[model samples]
Target: MRLSERLRGKRILITGVTGFVGEALLHRILADLPDTTVVALVRPKGSLSGRSRMEQVLNKKIFESSRNAAGGTTELLEQRIDVVEGDLSTIPGLPTGMDIVIHCAGDVSFDPPIDEAFRTNVLGTQQLLEKIEASSPDTHYVHVSTAYVSGRRRGAIPEGPVDHVVDWRTEAKWGQAMRDRVEETSRSPGILSKLRKEAEREHRRAGPITAAQDAERRRNEWVQKKLVEAGGERARSLGWTDVYTFTKAMGERVVEEFAQRMSVTVARPSIIESALETPHPGWIEGFKMADPLILAYGRGELPEFPASPDAIMDVVPVDHVVNAILAAAAESPEKGKPAYYHMASGARNPFTYAKVYEYIREYFDENPFDMSERGAVRLATWRFPGGERVERILAMSERAHKIAEYVVTHAPRGERIRKIAREVDQLQRRLEFLRRYMDLYRPYVEAELLFTDDRLMELYHRLEEADKEDFPFDTGIVDWRHYMVEVHCPNVTESMRKYDVIRRRRGRSAPTVAKELPESGEILAAFDMDGTLLSSNVIETYLWLRMPELDRTERVREIGTMLRKVPGFIRAERRDRGAFLRSVYRRYAGADLEELENIVDSVLAKHVLERVSAAALRQVRAHRAAGHRTVLITGAIRPLTRPLEPLFDEIVAAELATDDRGRCTGYLSGPPLVGESRAAWLIRYAGQHGFDLTKSYAYADSHSDLPMLEAVGRPVAVSPDVHLWRRARKGRWPVEEWKTSSAANRLAIPFADELPAERTS
Candidate 1:
């Protein structure tokens, strides 16, 4: 029977229906063979319902052809397909009346944990075959495998069963053992913390902590590191590149053993990429085999890869693989007969690594990605360094990474400084992930194997004259240059751009500050926390009394640090109060952020809020009543002003730098809000929110606040310092003594007659 005719009315069951290959096959079958009923096996993903999963697959671009053909509606297409929510590894049997079973599901992670790969690939296949034999023994089973099942072999890899020496069952048992070992090593967070505390206590008994002690204190991290290393080592020792392919080889053996009693056609396709032609050209899903490297290089990120310039990469389009699978299923051999067909183009039409690199460079040169800051990225053919050299480069990069981490942790905090540090950290992370990906793929990209697809070609030639037009698997017809330049690269670049735009929108800030600002008639009141609204600075109080004295020496040292500031303060009284106050807070660099916040909460509840000036409180209440957006500007740390947060709409203050793990990193995130910095922040905030700065009000007592006071229309000097009193008089700003309510109604400082009439407080 002809391939297309054979598919009519056939009840076909396909696993991995949501995957790239499965998605393409569903479209092709629906569009070409309208009479067939496709029973798809879909596993429920996290939070996504089974129906939703099926809808998502059908919603992809590959299904557009089928949807358009079905009268611009998916109603008919949905009626023709049946979806079963089940797992082959644990589920009992296939849905009833299935004449063909196409198993396309398998773990594809390059470094998946050993047990998971075996469970999904080897054990799952065994269970599926047994269930199929019992339920539908005559079903034509099409087993989708990979061309890399040939392992570390060179020269020409033929279409046949893999000669793996290890028993499949033994390998599966080893997988279970590894999983058990990993589970045994895993410990709860509570247990880990308890052990860490004990380790710390033990280290305290010694003079100074050693590297071994530190490692012991971080037991969870050490165990995780060991497990990751063990997985790769275990796979290599078993003669497979990774746990993925190792388990896949074992799965092929499962099919081999089952074919002894039933018909099974194993189709091993080489690195399946986007569609070249069929439903649509340049159609692909998320970053596949070669895409990550290509994109990274285009962005001037990847410097080198582990592959020879002359190595032949066997790549086949998704449409060709889908065609071969359907054809094989229709013309499968008799029961108890098994066959192997390699789906590859390397043995026929080959593209060397050098040619791929040249094409990439040429394409990018013609049309480069528009990275505003980096300009247009130019491609340089990557160097194929030996394994040892790659390791050496990675070690050097690690050392540089360590130095960067230290610098970011120790640098002074400021908005720009913090931003640069975060960028550095993110770049390092990207480089590390790229390194792992390249290392895992090194064997395949650098392999010297040529895969022959004689069986696939023979089947293609046997198709009927009209069938050949619909199903073309001949690799010789593919134009490598045209596909790379006109189809594949453009698709990749467009996809990347779309993803970046979506990402930016998802992460974008809601509105600009200028847009949020009020009009000229609207009110905006800015207040200073330390010595303006509050009687004293909260941070100094914490340093003096709230700190725990570990010992007499520590207590004396803390006291001396405070005392040493007295001379500087005395000089700053005649010089710069901003410099003195900034110096005082620098001592808080090494304090634990969470612990400091807790201390602030306790101190606020105990005594800080009680010190708020009554007169200043009344004035703040009056401003709020007039519908003002109150802003609190302070040189102190953010946590110290938590008690007053409800009284203000916005707070601008100094920030503390924290590590990726959210621990204090002994540095400030940004500069303290003092002197002209406070004025600049207010101006920027007003511009962002569209506020009229000329109508805003500011209240402060220090001479360092002169710039901020001058920027606002209504500047008030509350209990003005000597220098500020003189400036308030010179600028004709109001001066008020915010004395206790019991003493008087409001006391105005005797400002020079040139000043604005002193306001009552």
Candidate 2:
């Protein structure tokens, strides 16, 4: 009988209908097997119901032809498809009299947390089989699995059950228990201490609340990372490539136990790529197994191939895999043992990594991806150094990227620094992506397994000529060079490039300022002095004011003294802004206060005013126009802040204590206005002035001002440092880049060339 004839009018239940394979299978059935009724088991997502989610899937471009054949998407769903709401973990009650159950749902992450892998693949499959036995014992079951379940085995692997001694139930139990073990290890004194120290480095200046929260977040991340590492190690120890394949093999064992009760078949396909013929050639959803490496090579991010050049890369088109699945579902095994079929290409027509690289290079060299201002991306001949050596090289590159980022991030703020920082960030992100890619794919790429498809080929031979024409899955027919160069590469690049454009647009659309402002006296707009209102920092401002007081030789000596302590001062600044301010201010001890005040007044026009940001001035003027009180809260000395007193209603700045002789003592008259102290002062000031903090705004550029920003309803980050930028992005706060006058770049400061390059906090 024809394959479509056998499936016509049959009631089939499908899981993972939203996934790539399941959706393509559904579309194929709807287009070929007329009168068939399919029940799709889908889990509810966020606010969308199962039916709504299925509707969205039907709206995809891949289903266009199927939808048109059924008159429309609504008609297709109503007349042929039924959406059931449940997942394999819960195993909802099956629809009555199911003729077949095609189980397609499984976690596909290469190294997911062990618990998650077992829950979705091993335990979920067991529950599903039990449900099938209780609901419809006569139903023919077809379990979709991966050919890589062969694991570390080499040579030709035939269609059969995996050889193993471990019990499936015990393994599932152990895998699920891995999470608790990893969590306990994460909380050990040594691990917890390391995590806490890293968190403090990132968030100490933001205050105790932010630091504590960051520490907890780091602990959770550490636990998750440990769980993934444990899963990978356990899989490798048991001879499997990763947690995904290990759990999948366990799932097969579970299915075998239920084989005696009913007719069953297991279809294991090799690495599935874009569609070859059905739903139009080159149809694809997201990046598949090999797409990431291919794209990385094309973008010139990966300098070398990590796989053995002579190793066969068994790849089959998604449409071929889907067809084989349907063919297997049609020919169910007789009652006792389940039939196993390998839907792969290596046994019939092998394609090697060298051939893949040759084709990819040819295609890319002829048609290169334009990298905007950098022109076309240049491709290089890869030296196939294998996975381990490539990983070592990637590690070295990552370290170099980190060092470059550190230098760029610490450079003095300017247009040049901003450009370099951006480039460094991009390079760092690419390196991290490549590292993760290698971690997940190294096992598969380096493996020497060759999957044989004897059972699948026999099944194809059994089909009538008409059935063979209607459903073709013979792997020998695939043309590697034509498919790789003409179909798959074009499809991936076209789809992924559009996604890149959309992502860039979304990144640039983050609002920099609030659109609406009320005209009320109770509202407040608070600003931070250095780096927010002006381009200058305390070090630069101090040099501009104090350098002229000494001769060139004395000035050089003073700069050398301060430069030696810059690293320690930076560390102290990260730990406590108050302490850093006190230490840096001590350099002014024994200097005349009258002379310092006079120098500050004299430099107001040429040095300070020229450094003021025009964007910040406009914001203050807008606040004043709206009848909102404006305040400048800073750790800069009172004398230095005196020039900006007229711009704000109040100026709260540090004041140096003096001795009876009127010489500077270099001691703050009060606690430094930073971190938690800044927040507390703002709260008290608001209470006394009758201002509503919930309706007010605060702006700053340093992580030390995190507490003050958190105290207000609307907080803005102005040209913020890396720490502040991360917090602002997480909180969905407004971020503005305020530029200072161009003349500020030419301001003369002592030892500008000799001081270690560093960014202002």
In lDDT terms, which candidate is top? 2
lDDT of 1 by residue, 1-761 (tens): 66767888899989888888888888888878888889887887799866678887777666676767665435744667887777766654567668899999888777776677788999888998888888888888899989888888889988988776879898788776875575566555665666566554333211123323543546755455445556667768877777777778889999988888888999999888878887789888777888887788787777676667788878888999999999998976766668889999999899888778878778888888766555777666667775567667777887888887667544533334445565766678766876776678888876888888888888988898787887888887888888888888888789887776675564354221122334333667899877788666533554533354134577567767767777666565334444555566666655667756655554343345666778777777666776777899987777777778888889887676777766656456776777677888888888888777788889987666777887887788766654465566567577666544443212221111212233111
TM-scores of the models, in the order given: 0.69, 0.87
Predicted structure 1, TM vs. truth: 0.69
Instruction: Judge candidate 2 at residue 583 and give its lDDT.
Output: 86
For residue 343, give model 2's deviation from the true position in Å. 0.6
Off by over 4 Å in 2: 68-72, 409-414, 500-525, 539-568, 583-607, 622-629, 637-639, 650-671, 676-699, 706-761
List pairs with backbone clashes in candidate 2: none
Question: Considering summed lDDT, which 10 consecutive residues are worst modelled in model 2?
Answer: 752-761
Local accuracy of candidate 2 as per-residue lDDT tens digits, 433-464: 88887878778888888898988999999988
Model 1 residue 122 lDDT score = 90
